[model samples]
Target: MTHFGIICPPVTGHLNPMIALGYELKQRGHSVSLLGWEQHREMVEATGIHFVPILSPRQAPQPDQKITSSRRMRLRHKLHRLKQRLQPVDHQAYTQSNGISALRIALAAYQHWSAIALRAAPAVIKAKGIDVLLVSETSYGGSTVAEYMGIPFITICVGIPRHQSSAVPPYMTSWPYQLALWARIRNRLTYAWLDILQRRILRLLNRYRRDWNLVPYTTLTDSASPLASLACLPKAFDFPVSLPHNFYFTGPYINDICRKPVTFPFDQLSDKPLIYASTGTLSNQASVYRCIAAACDGLDIQLVISLGGKGRDVALSNLPGNPLVVDYAPQIELLKRASLVITHAGLNTILESLAQGVPMVAIPGVLDQPGAAARLERSGAGKFIALKQLNAKRLRKLIQEVLQDPTYKDQARQAQAVIQQSGGVKHAAAIIEDVLDLAHISV
Candidate 1:
């Protein structure tokens, strides 16, 4: 059986698609294993895949409480609780610094995380006997490891496509796909500026690769996967563009492969239309949650807000009306019953909403979200509102417009049908097998 090593950061969005693909591979008689944070060992192992821990000190600790009567035990418990509370703030400060912009912070975070992943990958790859490696595009280290070991690798674009193309605007912006002459020139210039900004990071990575006697990459992302890659979203969501022959959209992996079932107040539902709002697991800001909650206050609807794991400090008691506030919820299950969704324009959430035929009001926070939101609006499946302009009144108006209008739901269903036909996990498996076959023929 062919063995595959699934390498990615321990974020929920990144891990879900990889795990779904792994399940498809395993069912075809191939073996699959995941390499990620030590804290996620139990959760990953429970999925019946081999879990390889990175053992990095920077990895966040999972919440666990132990009771002990002794003074020493009590002291340790107190310290642990203190650490847990401070972690969110520390992480926020690191991600949102005054001197550095969010983009630079993301690059720095990626660089640091890749360094940790690189240190642990070689031994894991050797031990697992992985023939081909599948890496989420965001996991920069996986690509580095594959290059270092001279192994054929496949890159998975888990979010909006990040490939540099002149046909569409650059990612992480509110710009629409269709641009005038000046705008098109401006888009290319923006890309050029980004390349310049990332030159130092690219140089550092190339230098790191030289230590292992590997060729330098032109850009940080350009040389990550030289063989084949998978785009996890449906083809309909992307603007028209030419791609490499090896690059293909394998549809969204919408299966419940790697998700844990969450309990929500399902029985307490009223006849009013249900609105599910979330800013994804990582970008769940308390202010955004408060705005969404307040907007739906006194309205004839059930509003459910997922705080993600980062909103521990947000107090739910002071919320307006009887809005349901939970740390996490069963998103897919909720979407099935939801008439509308208010999201951060995260690709995962957007795809999920579309797949379930639920219209959305996207409020993109950062990263590729803004680009994805713009696409959503263009597709007629949803609309986007700027974070600065978002308020109780504006959000209420948008929600009413989307719900009262039938075009949004119709377009969402159209996207849903395309997703279904794109041949999700089954198509992805066939692509990987073809790549393997090609390798064998070359050998």
Candidate 2:
């Protein structure tokens, strides 16, 4: 049995899928452990997987540290200002400026976390005697750690596909798929610009590689595992593009049976067609929720807004619609009953909605969400509006279009069929085992 070490960001969206994959591997008689911050120890251990604390005591956030908390608040405020600055007029200019701002913030965070991991991960992996590693695609530090130790690792694409292709637009933009030569040129130029922006991050990583006497990466994509790369995205939900031979689409790494039970007020739900709205576990802005409530105010549907555990500050009673607002809701259960979903175009939410045969109105805010939203519109499964362009009237119109038209639901069902056939955690596990076996043979 292979002992696997899982590495990913501590956020809910990334952690949930990686934890589910770890749980599946453990069920198959393999041992699995997650290396993360000490704060997430309880959350990881609760799933029956071992948790290895990676951050030094000094680096870890203290519960009573007012300074750390204040810093976080300030960062949140800065991000909010960036989002607010994105105007509907001059869409291209705003998209570029906002995208750059977001990327700068993300890279800064990653660089900080990666420095900690580089210092701590080698000792942790050695102590645990891990045989294989499963690193999240976004967790570049994990890949570096695996290489430093000369251990085999696989890349798990928990978010959108990050493979660079001239035919596909960058993941940060909501541009639709186009096959024209000019579209390819635009894609190439955007990619070059992104590479230039990421030069500092690349330099930081390469310095460590040179220190370790290992070959330095030329580009960010060079860090991905050559053995295998697994994505939770289904083929039908993605744009038609060629992927690397080692890459495999293994559907979503979801295990409902392994999830902790959540308490939801089912009786409060009305008989009218259900419209479930969420902005995922992060990016919970009160203004976005207000707009959603206003759009659904006079509609015939029953609206339920989930704050994703980040909306405690939002006053529910003051919202325009008397919608059922909760700090958190059992999303999968609600999706089963939902006639439509209004989402932030998060991959997990979109995949879950599709799995339930529910159409969506996507409002992509940041990161890979715009790419996922673009694919949603391209697939005919749903429609999307830029977050800057979102208003009560426009959102309500799209909501009506998705609900009144049967075509959206039909397309969702088609995607549902593909998801059902695509093996989830089990398939991913099998692929990991196969790659491990192949690596052993080569050795």
Candidate 3:
């Protein structure tokens, strides 16, 4: 049996897919283990995979600050504010500060997590006789372990493809697939800056690699399963562009097999068309929740809002038609009954919605969310409203349009077909076996 070690960031979106992949590999008689943060240990262990802890560097605001949903600026939010602070100074000043600052923060976080992973991993690899390593796109340290140990590794990318390409807009920017001349030039420049940031990250990575006598990597992407880059998302979500030779679009890696079913009150709802809304694990603005409640106020829609992160005691008093407010919901189950979803355009949520043929109204905030939202709009599967422009009236209108129009649902089904054909973890497991076969690595 081939022993596989999977490394990932602690976030739910990243960990969930990796957990699913581990189950699939284990089902095939391969041993699977996961290395990540301590908080996720219970969840990982619940999957019956060996769990290794990666020490997380305490950021200024703490990790929980990031998960807290409020209007007050958290530490990371302060960094964003600092980024915007440079905007009025000068173009170059804003670009340099904003780009480098964000890159440094990410590098710092990755460096801490990776350093811990690198130190703890070799021993585990040796003990387990691990044949292959599966690394999350966010876990920079996993690549270093592969480099140090000379093991075959496959990158599991769950979200927007971070690799720079002229055909696609640089990640984090909400630019659509179709672009004009100026837009194209802007896109190129975005990639250029992105490369600069990646190079900065590479420098830090190489510093750690030096201790192991491994060669320095020129491109950050090189560290990501160079032999076989695996994208857990389907090609349908990405732009029409050529990918690298080793890149494999392995489709949505939903953890359906091991997914713990969440129970929701089925008897506590009206007969009105159900609308499911979530702002994701991080940053569920109470204001947005209130807006949604007001929008659907007295309307013929029963709104189900998932206020993610730390759930406070919420009284549904004075809300429109007594909307259901829960800390979390059985999202897959909700989408099954939902006619429309209001989301932050997280990759997993978008894919889940597509799989269920549920249309969306994307409300993206920060990171790759904007790009995901743009993809939804471009594909005609959903519409996006900027956070700055969100209100009860506009949101209500969009919801009304989505419910009334059949085109959105039709398009969602088309994407669903793509998702199904791409195959889930089963296909990924097959491809991994193929990679092992090509390498002549004995099981």
Query: Best candidate per TM-score, number?
Result: 2
Please give, for residues 39-135, the per-residue lDDT of candidate 3 as tens digits: 7887888878888664422222222221234423342354344334222213122222323343445445555556556546666676667778998
Better of 1 and 2 by lDDT: 2
Clashes of each: 0, 0, 0
Q: Which candidate's lDDT is highest?
A: 2
Which lDDT values do the candidates have, in the order given?
0.75, 0.81, 0.74
Name model 1 segments beyond 4 Å from true.
57-90, 94-100, 281-284, 441-443
Name the 10 consecutive residues with the lowest summed lDDT in model 1: 60-69
Q: Model 2, residue 139: displacement in angstroms?
A: 0.5
State every prediction's TM-score relative to the real structure: 0.88, 0.89, 0.85
List where candidate 2 sits over 4 angstroms from the true fold: 56-98, 281-284, 441-443
TM-score of 1: 0.88
- Over the stretch 355-414, how does candidate 1's per-residue lDDT look in tens digits? 899999998766787888998998999898977678888988898889889999999999
Full-model lDDT, candidate 2: 0.81
